[model samples]
Target: MLSALRLGQIDRYLLGQLLAGLVASTGGLVALIWLTQSLRFIDLVVNRGLSLAVFLQLTGLLIPSFVAVILPITTYVVVQFTYQRLASDRELTVMRAAGLSAYALSRPAMMLALISVVTCFVLDVWVVPSASAAFREEQFRIRNRMAAFMLQDGVFTQVSDDMTVYVRRRDSDGTLHGVMIDDARQKNAHATILARRGRFLPSTDAPRVLLLDGTRQEIDHQTGRLNILTFAQNVIELSSNKSTAQRFRDATEMSLGELLHPDPAVVTARDRPKFVVEAHRRLTAPLTAASFAMVALVAVLRGAFQRHGGLLRPFIAVLVVVGLLAVGLMIANLAARVPALIPLIWVHAIAPGMVCAWMLFVPELRLGRLSSLIPGAAA
Candidate 1:
């Protein structure tokens, strides 16, 4: 009973260390990735005049997706590091001498991997889909509707692909001074408008600007004659006639059911393979956490201890993991194109852990030395 209690205490200590290392490494990597990824949207804040809070809110929706992708990798890294440290400190040696088997020593890491698997499932199935939808919707709104309102004082702002607006000065009362617009929405009738003063109209569907004392100038396409018309007040729509209905949902923004049974109207036959691949990817991705943790355990705990601490096994394990990650990426890409190979994804996610677990545990069982495989059995 005393030995069992002591073993439990050691397991708790190991689990605590693994959990701490996982949190720190995961957080640091996530923050670094977020910084790099958020750079793609820095123009929204700098050029579009979006506030810092709004920028943070928009980019923050991406954290769940990032966590889901990196959790398995981080789990493997933490387990590998923690076990190697214990071994280098001769703590694993002490545990082995105390009659702790390989399974007993690896129990804490298995628990950690299980936790990661559960978290990854929750993120991939629920949190990521909703957050991705919201991010895309918000990005669309900012580009289409709110972009006109974000015009800077002196910089030319591309409100939409077909429209460019420039304002010389903007007042706190929402009045603009000296505005110019280059409208190319019409195929052959490109027009340039110059306004002495203007203000954006309150709108939700499409942005519009009301110009005062403005002149609309256009060159006739056929005759090449410049025609200028002066008006006291005119309303120019800032964005093209694009409605929210025109926005198509991406696979990342779809739930599992939606991916599996997509609307034929929205998803064409050519795109069906992509949807199927995404659904299967989400289902199988979480299983990789267990597989990766098992690989790390096989690296640190599988072989006999060297008096001088060998680096060959750990280095080989790292190479194997990198190779597996590359292969997984290739398989996902191939499956996306040729979905007949979808079973490869499931095999990729599950096979490594199964093989590693057998190598680590089943061989010991086959030796007919159950006493050596169980903690305190030799006693």
Candidate 2:
């Protein structure tokens, strides 16, 4: 009962520490992301001809995606820092004297970890996917508007392969006079055609191009034959860089529920290992929050606080947690790619530090204590 009570109190303290740590950490991270993304926006606006409105809007929408990538790392860092502060202040020692085992103190960290897991799952499953879909949808919309840039007057417009067309003038009625076509690759090597006037027709489903009017002339260079072709109007295709469509997506966009319930046509044929691994990743990411919390707890119990530079050990603990999390993530990703060891992906994410949490629960592993479970700890 005493041990349970002691654990409960430490858990409360840890909770207090966690709340403060989360606000300071996530706030700073979000601000850093905004500043960096804004610089990228300026570059796109000045150099890539992106509109300020679109750039800013895209920047705002991109925050969720960034958060999805950085949230685990952020949680891990904060947890480590918070625990290290307690250790530095000798609060950990006080809690231990009150019959609290490291394991008991770890309850709060584990609770926080559990929360992290649920939060990460929601992000990967819902928030990130929706934001990504919106980002892609708006990108297509932006490209369509940008395609108008190709409508330059008095230039040879090559909209696609096998179509080269030139227009001398564009009338207000959307008519082009003195149309010249060098469509040699389209059919029988038609070298050039001169028209009195021409009109543009954009495909409703496809890209837009030009249609010639008046008279058309054709020549076969192989036979040195000049063929006079006359028509009321002729069709020519021009290429435009505007896309108003979305490409087919692979499995990365899917959530755990969707992946498990995938269509036979989508999931059957040739199985994709990346997607299978990603599904497992989604399942395991939530566990990472708890695992990160444990690591932080251990670091906190072992850390010391300096009277003058109080936050340094805590700060270093945060960095260490972040670094270890990054390494674990990288290992999991690489394991997912290897077909022979794909099943190891889950292990990579969750197994690395299982023993770290044990130190908190068992007193023997802690400093100046041995066999606390034995009748009289000293032999």
Q: What would the TM-scores of all predictions be?
A: 0.92, 0.66
lDDT by residue (tens digit), candidate 2, 1-379: 4444544565677887786777678778887988886785575477546878888787777777666666667677777766666665777667676655555566666666777677778887788767767776665555444322344478886634555667788888877777776665546655577778766565443434455455566666677777887676666544332232345555666776666566666666345556666677767766666666666666666433344435554566567666766776776667556756665656755764576656555545555454443323322
Best by lDDT: 1
Model 2 off-target regions past 4 Å? 1-13, 34-57, 90-104, 149-246, 257-271, 302-340, 364-379
Weakest 10 consecutive residues of candidate 2 by summed lDDT: 237-246
| Candidate 1 per-residue C-alpha lDDT over 1-379 given as tens digits, one digit per residue, 9 for 90 to 100 | 6777787798899999999999999999999999999998898778667789989999999999999999999999999999999999999998988778888889999999999999999999999999999998888777667656578889898877788899999999989999999998887889999999998898876778899999999999899999999999999888875643478899999999999998899999899989999999999999999999999999999989876677998898899888889999999899889888999999999999999999899977887768756766654
Cα lDDT of all candidates, in order? 0.90, 0.63
All models, RMSD in angstroms: 2.4, 6.5
* Clash-forming residue pairs, model 2: 88-305, 102-360, 103-360, 103-361, 117-286, 159-238, 159-239
